[model samples]
Target: MTPTPADKPPSQALFSTIAARYDRCNHLFSLGIDRYWRKQLAQTLVLKADDAVLDICCGTGDMALSVLIHTPVHCVWGIDCSETMIQLAQEKRIRRAGRGRLRGKTLRLSVQDAAALAFEPGMFAAVTCAFGLRNIPDRARVLAAVFRVLAPGGQVGICEFSLPRFGLLRSVYWAYLSRVMPMAGRVVIGDAEPLRYLARSIDHWHKTVRLEEELAGAGFVDCHCRLLTGGIVTLTVARKPGPLAAQPFL
Candidate 1:
């Protein structure tokens, strides 16, 4: 299916319609680099077995599953805005068969919006979001919610696509993401606007340094960001300070 520019949704409903194929298009369009980027983010997290993890905007749960496999996190709770995406994530969980058991970890998925999470304060030891923040309209609120839900000394990891700074590499990245990806989406999934929006959002996102400051503003400490693929993607890690304060919501 080749995507036309009109294939993207103005609201959430249209996005749900293509949820089933989103993963497929993502891998194809990114040439499988997406998984590596996610793996990098998960690795940077350095999760321990006792950690309670939350994956926001989990989208089919690839990053969450990665954490379940490589990290010692006791449980991974995945949340996504799209119910269809959650359904697909659950199906993937079933397909994994005994992988969860082998690691002694559990995977949970639910349809939840990032801006309005249903979690108790200081409940998660770690939180992650890969390639999901840009789609959100209110990222600051989401980050604050993430801060509220994380336990002291907890870490947050974010993996997201970003524009390159170097002119030549940025040009190539833009050509591939903005031009080639939409064409591929049209041919592969018969949709285009979703990828188009993806490109647009990446362009519209905060600069890496600015984003790290946003994390600090949300009460995270030792915030940092690493550029991947010539700045085509960014992996951010931040930690909650020790000596937990009572959450106002709690």
Candidate 2:
């Protein structure tokens, strides 16, 4: 139980160590409901052809693939902090191309930190992060980064695990997230540490209202959330307003 400077586990090292088994453990921990969650997120964004989308913390590119499958988006870029995860994503890209699933167009995956995005302003039409925000300690910085890279009126969609809103559901969710998830990680991934971090991070996450307020404060407008599966997870969507010229102060 080592702590980092940010009062969280060293996510970079932890994710690097567990990159190979990350997806497997996700399936086990969520009882495979993660797929449905990702689908809902992709659907909410309403991606279109010729649209540019950025998937931050895009481990193994599942959400990106979901976009490709559901939307006729011209380009999809997936980025993560872990190089190993990027490698796997690239390998999958290659396989997808070989199978004639993706041709002519390019699918890109790279190692990039969300808090310091390496892109020009308004580069993407939409942005997404799935099950990744909690791992980031400086949430506000990342949200600011998201705002900077997004074009005015670009949409942002985020899906994350949350404690259930109902009492009975919260108890069941906690037991599965805390105890069963770690055990499944040990049995399936052969690494229990990352799962422990995943659980602890969610347990200590800022409340939903606080997060919504933070997004609004960071320049996201029309922010709204839909709690899924009895609030075990929440998907929030917001749009960056058109260029903010000087306005009279109240």
Candidate 3:
């Protein structure tokens, strides 16, 4: 059932309406560079056996799967509120059985909320959320929840859209996002408001420095930012305090 905007909860409706087109629309809006970001994240993340990682807002589980493929982590836990998204991810996981790569890694998929995670405290060695932090309505709560669930020294890596570094390019990108993205979205997936909401989130998001401050405020240590796609996107990495995370805990 495709939900109209009038549905009881609009965000859920919006996500449900677009699940089928979500991946394609992402590729379109990102100009196909988003895949590269995921690959880079997977490569950069250091993982080890007995490391249990959580992936919040794990839509379609692409980044989680990328992590699974790239590292020898003991397990990957993916949670998303969108049932359709989980279904798609599950299907993909099943299809990839032929690859015989995940035989030893446990990949758990569940429909769960980001702001209020169900996992036990100190459960994960690291957490990753790709293009997910913006969609969470309670950013602080989600960060706190993530902090709580992570083991001491657990790290988090977030990949998300950001304002470009250069003023002229930022202006051009913002204009295109605000003006043309919705139109193209309408043609591509029959949904414009969601894309517009995405644009607004990016437009109004805190700068990278402020984001790093927010992470630090949430008790993460040594927070830093890395610009990607010429600063059209940013990857913020932070770690929970303590020594276990000095190296991936086996």
Cα error of candidate 3 at position 14, Å = 0.9
Structural similarity to truth (TM-score) of each candidate:
0.89, 0.89, 0.88
lDDT of 1 by residue, 1-250 (tens): 2443442324667568778888888788778988888878777776668778999989889999988876666689999988888999999888884764435568989999888889999999889999877666667899999998998888889988788889999888789888998888888778887778777667667332367878888888877788898888888888899853321110
- Computed on alpha carbons, the lDDT of every model, listed in order, comes to 0.80, 0.80, 0.80
Residues 69-109, candidate 2, lDDT per residue (tens digit)? Answer: 66677688899999989998888787787344455556788
For candidate 3, give the lDDT of residue 33. 84
> Looking at candidate 1, what is the lDDT of residue 165?
87
Better of 2 and 3 by TM-score: 2
Question: How well does candidate 3 score on lDDT at residue 148?
Answer: 96
Quickly count the clashes in candidate 3.
Answer: 0
Candidate 1, superposed: residue stretches over 4 Å from native: 1-10, 100-103, 206-209, 243-250
